[model samples]
Target: MISKKAIQIFSVGIIAPLTLQSCQQNAVTNSGDADTLTGRLVITGSSTVAPLVSEIGKQFEGENPNVRIDVQTGGSSRGISDVRNGIADIGMVSRGITPEDDDLSFHSIAQDGVGIIIHQDNPVDSLSDEQVKQIFTGEISNWQEVGGEDAPITVVNKAEGRSTLELFLDYFALSNSQIKPSVVIGDNQQGIKTVEGNLFAIGYVSIGTAEFSVSNNVPIKLLPLNGVMANGDNVANGSFPLSRPLNLVTNGEEDLLTQAFINYSQSAEVHDLIKKQDFVPLSR
Candidate 1:
């Protein structure tokens, strides 16, 4: 639950907008009263960050009754583009902001890990980093080669423009052209579902999303990455090798309402919401 101070921080001293700006054009609606904090924010970006942000948005709206938040998912790239192009009030980006995005303000709300996942029914508990690379590269097409039951491996890869895909390819030292995938997924849930339905399928997704699925009795396992467990605790402590920040990005200077939401999202008030999504909240 959010604290009173946290809610007040976003609700207090917010005057209604008079004129439409680039970010405010048609996206925000205001009540007639100047004292009321009434508006709508359109947030778009990483599918990985969408669910968590959606939950946070709901809580935020609950606190500030007059405000509305809309969260949409495409990929991390879309988030960056939408914010930069002023199509969205905020963008949910899962990866670290690169030098190319110097003009954008990135507010990191939490941490998550990218990890390899396979059906729990598979006997193979873990794979060496090299083995993972080989599997995706079609060098090891059969699960038997990795000590699993005899079956053709179903390779699940992330679609292009996804932060998960970029992180995965970088850590494994593989290129997109090198991957021979049976399926390409757009988001973490889709990847998790694909692996869940196919016993021989192997995919990668956010460790936080995978953990949340596992907790709900999903038939999937998050394999250790180079002997390190793929979980939020490991990411929070910096022990996980393939972790990335969950950020809310803004194109330029933010409106007062936008700034308030950003501050609340990063504050300790939303730690439980972050944990509920299996993500590691920023340290206070």
Candidate 2:
């Protein structure tokens, strides 16, 4: 049996979004009165970062009592747009900002290893980067060609606007290559579920989501990239082909809440949380 203290810590630490809206509202109201700062903080971006941000928001609200952090799951592009338009305070992304997003300050809070995933029953254990490029670019249509069970390959992809999709395309030099129209587009969870349910399907997801999927006994396996496994050590060493920075974009000019959150993110407490969430914390 789990100890009460352990269970409590787990509840507060891992089971996220700790309180409902009513309690949140009260906490916000009290904190606003005490700090004399009041407003809802909007954070939009990568569903990959959603759970982490949401957990942070819960903890931040618990501390501040006044600021309400509203988190949303739009793709990275939309998140950037929201911040640029002053609709959001922070934009979370699994990829770096483009040249056009020069005005907003980009803070990389963590690193994520993107993994090529397939159903567990699928015989393939690993893939070279070139083979991955071929598979995603529509060059390889049969699983047998890549040492997998004989079946037509079904490529599941994140939506076009997603940072994961953009990163994979750019990484593989497939930016100009046309993807077959049949590519299934979905969010991270859906992408994992689709691949888990279909033996012939292949997809990519962040390490955080992959961990969650595997924890839940989802029938999916993370394929190594160019023989290097997708893990924190490989990601930190730059051996993982799909490793990318996860960022929290803010206005360069620091504000109270923004600075507070940034400081908190670098704290030891949150660093452990980042690790528990299966992301590589940014080096101090």
Candidate 3:
């Protein structure tokens, strides 16, 4: 569901709509010959935002033959640093830019929420926010304490530099140094797999990513936070309590190709693609 705000931005062509209005412009832009616009645009950032942005890049490349968009994932922090240092043409950040972020420009691409996950066999369907915080902080170390098995609780945490880790920590008002993780993972699937393979393990990741994997029999369940369901529908409807913006950041001036790609990402054309990847599209 694209937001009405995003639709207005896209309609007015904040950066110019990807849909050129005239057959003549299309003829020139897609002349069937090698486009004069040839450049490699590198985007590195959040694994959460990577899949959707990669899809956008692929679609954009198909329309403009000579443009090559390379998308990579490390974490949102890496994306911020890489773009600021000119190591990347664009940074895919799953979180908002801060006031101290040197005033870089960003385009909101989508929205996602951080969610807790546990093995499917675990009977505990949800935990209160305080309980979640205590679990990560090592204050609650046994399943029985949380109405589960008598086994010890295995905590899976995200590694440093990952935005997932950043948000999880912030949500619980915790510091990285305070968490006691039995295992640390980098991406959503890594965290999910860790929880899936360990019946007593509890971890967190993107709700959209986790839902997609669960539908495909990933053997995991999303834990409710503050008694609210963690799903795309809840997130889009603003009923989900925990959520974050997905963005693409550029340090300064962008080349024509880079700007065009950004416009394409923000356009209405990729709304379905964003949904296909289990993320909420910007408002239409």
Candidate 4:
């Protein structure tokens, strides 16, 4: 006759092996194909879309430890050219490419609002589309002429290859004429800084950078276009004329990693992330 202690010990010994085996199986299952993906993905494009793409790259890399994503911000045209020439696997753009970009395939990932921002100290609250057109085209040279203080208007513009510059020129039908040489040309961040530091300066920037300007207490205000405020809701409803689709262009032949990135971008998990980055999700 076996004692109770002996029987208990026998039961424990039987269960422990099964429990260990179960855990080992789970570990193997959980680790399935996680190491199968390994390579570098190069993404380049609009400085306007850089922050959002950077965030996506960070999160995606965290999940797939074997992959590396490199992100660079060259102006939008450069991005399109890079992808077309196979310099990058992904190219982000704030504006759409033309038929000349036929060799490259584009995926619209998000939407962005372009707003004319002024120093907060400036009392001008709004401007009609015509007024904005005139201001950027150098037709309006004085703040007082537009109901602001008695100061000369300083127009800050993005560099020649930038998407913002192209958008502004197209929106105002100034494509045939070169941007006034007198306009101060700067990169995305520089444009924001210039407007913030100069009380009479006005510039155009994506909503993301504009939000950063506000957060940094740059004393800047986003002016309405055509009397319609440039906010997420207005942009979504097409009420904001300056709103444009942001894109991720590739060679169009889908690969595992490219598909993975696209899937991630279209996922619900990334929708809020897109919004937090101050852009509207394409899904919405």
User: lDDT of model 3 at residue 276?
Assistant: 94
Which ranking of candidates, highest lDDT first?
Answer: 1, 3, 2, 4
- 3 against 4, candidate with superior TM-score: 3
Worst 10 residues of 3 by lDDT: 5-14
Q: Which residue pairs in model 3 clash with each other?
A: 2-283, 2-284, 3-282, 3-283, 3-284
For model 4, the local distance difference test gives: 0.72
Q: Deviation in angstroms for 54 in model 1?
A: 1.3
Would you list the clashing residue pairs of candidate 2? 27-65
Best by TM-score: 1
Model 1 accuracy (lDDT, Cα): 0.84
lDDT string for model 3 (1-284, tens) is 22222111111102333322321122124334444666566676787888888778778877766666666677788778778767777888988777867668988989999899999999998898889889889999998998999999999998888888888888789999999999987788788888889999999999999999999999999988888889999889898888999999987677666777888899999999999999998886
- What lDDT does model 3 reach? 0.80
lDDT of each: 0.84, 0.72, 0.80, 0.72
Per-candidate TM-scores read 0.88, 0.84, 0.86, 0.84
Residues 38-94, candidate 1: write the lDDT tens digits: 677777778778878887877888888988776666788877888888777898899
Error of 4 at 47 (Å): 0.4
Deviating ranges (above 4 Å) for candidate 2: 1-38
